[model samples]
Target: MNPFRYERALDVDHAVQAASQGGRFIAGGTNLLDLMKENVERPRRLVDISRLNLDRIEPLSDGGLRIGALARNADLAGHPQVLRQYPLLSSALMAGASPQLRNMATTGGNLMQRTRCYYFYDTATPCNKRSPGSGCGAVGGCTRIHAILGASEHCIAVHPSDMCVAMAALGATINVAGPQGRRTIPFEEFHRLPGDAPQYDNTLGEGELITGVDLPAEGFAGHYSYLKIRDRLSYAFALVSVAAALRLEDDGRIAEARVALGGVAHKPWRLPDAERMLAGETPGSRVFARFADALLEGATGQGDNEFKIELACRAIVRALEQAANGTPQSQVDKRIA
Candidate 1:
């Protein structure tokens, strides 16, 4: 790692000031430190904001959750309010990384973490995301793990945050603090799609620090689940993942639904068309399958990852079915195990 000066922040204001001086904010250090060591990220200074009083999970007056950016991933995932009211978010967090890493990782850090693209991490490979105009190595190289949606010719890397997937479905908002003060950004617009400017990953300006995430309450409670498919059983990134929340009427007709996808896009992929199809319709395997098909429309896949389109569709269908039926724990265990 390059030699850098370190400063412990006293508060949000101090952190923002320090960041304005070309210093990188350090919270969990799970992602930042690794990138710095790899020489993928080099900062002259590190501002530690772990001491800031932004670690609370407060219930908003509007019937939502105000999650502190400094809140640890494990704490946020295991919070009773999150588990009961926002089960999809909890499930997505639990499906990510491992217990140890989650214990140390923070909500804001996870959202800002860079993609796990092999080329971006290796200094030897030429990647536009790593160094603009360096060119892309994944275009015709090994790209099984690359994206199929919202990808440009310069970058095919998928966003790596599982928590953010659920947040996207829940209509979360990001609160950012910077030298110029504070501003809120909608979750959908916070992470940018890989367009011609693949080097820019988010709407956050340089030196801006994410303060917290606000999840606005919607009425899609009781029916929710997160399903992640990977090559291994545990502690692995998703090949394709689904975060779904649904509401069913007394007559077994869907009243509402929210769906977002991960591991198949440059950002969290939400399908309003699929959600619209589910509304007022009876929740059945056939209905869920049809909705999944609608969601996968226009998905362009590469050679090796063409199978992902089918796998992603099936995963979404299965997740919706599981959420609708409230499958028994034993049955779910058998199926997943």
Candidate 2:
């Protein structure tokens, strides 16, 4: 890793001030440290926010929850309020890395996590995200883990966070503070497509630091499923993951539905129109399959990832079925059903 100055922040204001001088904000240092070692992120300074008072997970008067940016993934998954009101988030967190990494990965860090592709991490190859103006190697290189949706000619990288996918499905809001002031960003608008600038992952402004996340009152806790399909049963990134939530009417018809896809796009792939198509419709394979097709529209893969199109469609159907049946995939058991 490169030599860099390290400063421990005393509070939120201190952290933002420290980062205003081109210093990068780091909490938990789980992914940042690895990237530094690989020479992917070489910052002149690192402002540590681990000791800041931003680790609490509290309930809101409106029945929602406000999660601190520094809250560890493990703590957030196990919090009583989270398990009771937002089990989909808990399931996604559990489906992520091992317990040791979870203890060190914070909520804000996960939100700020960068997109990953074979060439982005391999310094020897050309990667537009890693080095702007350098050709995108992922366009023809190993694309098994690359994006299929919202991919531009400049890059085809995919975000690697199970937690973000679930949060997108639940309609979580991001809270941030910067030199300008504090602001809230809707989850759908936080992460953006590659477009022409593949280097910038999200719309977070310069010197802004995420403070917390707001989960709306309706979490669809009773009918939710987080399904991850990876090469291995544990400790591997997903090939295609699905977070499905539903509200069943008293007549057994679908009142509402939400489906967010991971390992398939630059952000948690969600389409409000596809979700609206399921409203007031009957829950069945036909309905869910059509919804999947609508969500996957315009999704053209690079090469090896073409299989992901069908895989994502089937996974979406299976996830929705599990949600409707009230049988969420067990994170501990590692079984499909």
Candidate 3:
């Protein structure tokens, strides 16, 4: 890793102050440190925010929950409130890295985690994300884990955050503090699609520190599912993942439906029209399959990853069926139930 100055932030203000002056914030250091060591990230300075007083998991007045940025993945997954109110998120977190990693990964770090594309991590290859203006090697070279939807000619790397997929389906709001002031960003608007600029991941401006995330009261806790399909069962990044949440009426008709896709694009993918198609309709294989078709309408896959298009469509249908039947996929089972 390149030499860099280190600073331990005393508080939020201190962290923002240190970062606004061209310092990168480090909390949990799960994803950031790895990139640093790989020479992919060579920040001039690192401001440690791990010790900041921002690790609270509290209830909101609107029957929602607020998750602190510093809250560890393991702690958040097993938290009583989270398990009770947002089990979809808990399941998603559990489906991510191993127990050791969950113990160290933090809320903000998970949001800021980079893609796991082989070319992006390999400095020898051309990766637009790592070195802008350089050609995208994943476009034609080994695209097994690249994006299938919302991909541009510039880059096809996919975001690899299970937690984000769940959060997107649950309509979570991200709260951030910056040099100017504090603000809240809608979950869908936080992460951007890689059009021409693949170098940037999210819309987080300079010196903006994610303080916490707020889940709206309507979590669809009664019915939700987080299903991740990976090459390996243990600690493997998803090739296709789906997060589904549905609210059924007393007559077993769907009241509301929310679906978000991960490991398929630069950010968690959600289509409001596809979700709306399920509203006021009875749950069935035909309807869910139609919804999947609508969501993947414009998806085009690169070579070697064309299978992902079919896999994502099927996963979406299965996840929605699980949510509608009140049987979310069990992470321990590892089978498409």
Model 1 stretches astray by more than 4 angstroms: 328-334
Model 2, stretches more than 4 Å misplaced? none
* Root-mean-square deviation (CA) per prediction: 1.8, 0.7, 0.7
Q: Which ten residues in a row have the lowest lDDT in candidate 2?
A: 112-121
- What's the lDDT for candidate 3? 0.94
- Report lDDT (Cα) of residue 14, candidate 1: 89
lDDT agreement with native, every candidate: 0.87, 0.93, 0.94
Q: Model 1: per-residue lDDT, tens digit, 5-112?
A: 999999889888888889889999999889998999989999999999999999999999999999999999889998778877887888889899999999999999
lDDT of 2 at 326: 95
Q: Is candidate 1 or candidate 2 better by TM-score?
A: 2
lDDT of 3 by residue, 226-272 (tens): 99999999899999999999999999999999999999999999998
The lDDT, on a scale of 0 to 1, for candidate 1 is 0.87
